[model samples]
Target: MNPCDTMLADDEAVIRALLNEVPFNGWTRTALRRALAACNRDPDDAAFLFPGGAADMIETWACLADRDMEAAALAADLAAYRTPARVRAIISLRFEQNRPHRDAIRRAIAVLALPQNAKRAATITARTVDSIWHAAGDRSADFAWYTKRALLGGVYTSTLLFWLRDTSDTDEDTIAFLDRRLNNVATIGKTRKAITDKRPKLRIPMPGFMRTWAERA
Candidate 1:
């Protein structure tokens, strides 16, 4: 691999390793530096690797999760399912993959939700939904592309937050919540389409003299 790719991979590894300490250290730069030091790497490298500190770590964590989700999607046999089913499967796989590290994930989410990190959070969320769509075989390049991603981003973010707080066995409650959110998105899309279809077409108006003549006749 090229130097840039290799460096990025190394940085990602370091950040991921730091996550094991997040639940205790609170997802701060100090904890990341401590993690780097524990690995016998220069603790100062934390600044160079993640300039935004905890916020950067949070974004990178989501990216790693996205990559894991894509890999799982690629390995699975999803040919039998339709588009929506494929999407649901990808999300389910993503959640399952992160279940082991939910505490760290929750900490990251809290960091991302901070006011200073809002932009990074939105960007990361957008990237995640886009990646999920790509994994689900969505290749649309039209106006619907933006709308589809917007709708899915909302659903994914809400479902993720819900899942983070869920306590049901095997995450059954979170899965049900996800289904409901997806259905809501589908319902909104259908309603918008129906409204568009039923809208009355505009007509050219005739002159007042012609209208009076026709009425008199």
Candidate 2:
């Protein structure tokens, strides 16, 4: 029998009572917050308090959120500190990239023609990114970025469920749609150029017609 099952064999099995159960009553959050506070208050305690890999991951995120980049970078260098939660610590700091980062992106696109491909791409990407950032604006300490990062796990989970329920090749439908749109756009451009090149000019009256009429009179 599984360890959990053996423990649950008797109603009085206190050990098996709550193992592996998801804590929905805020107890988990409270414990996590208290642990984090203790570690923050005493650096010496971190070696003892955060003995596990999970603790290392949690503290790594804390360092980044606190903007102690050097410490954050150090923690990130450690294998145990790497986790999806870490990606989120940076994303949550998404208040806007600092000027240096933004300047770098701007410079990369500066050589492109303004109001054209690169300009249009930059504008659309910013609008899309803003909508994602707003998804976390109401939370303190950018909890939105945390929740958004968590939502990535949901994407794969949801896609699996969709594939199971879908009766047709959804991938094929998507491909065909893209193919048709591309063909229509290509044909329109070709047709437009042809028509423009063949368009005729208006005729002007001949001065010879007036001179001939005067000679006849």
Among all candidates shown, the one with the greatest lDDT: 1
Give the worst 10-residue stretch by lDDT in candidate 2: 13-22
lDDT of 1 by residue, 99-150 (tens): 8788998888787878988887888888889989999998987556766888
Each prediction's TM-score versus the true structure: 0.84, 0.19
The candidate scoring highest on TM-score is 1
The regions of model 1 sitting more than 4 angstroms off are 1-7, 37-40, 199-217
Clashing pairs in 1: none
Which residue pairs show backbone clashes in model 2? none
RMSD of 1: 9.7
**lDDT for predicted candidate 2 compared with the true structure:** 0.33
Per-model clash counts, in order, read 0, 0
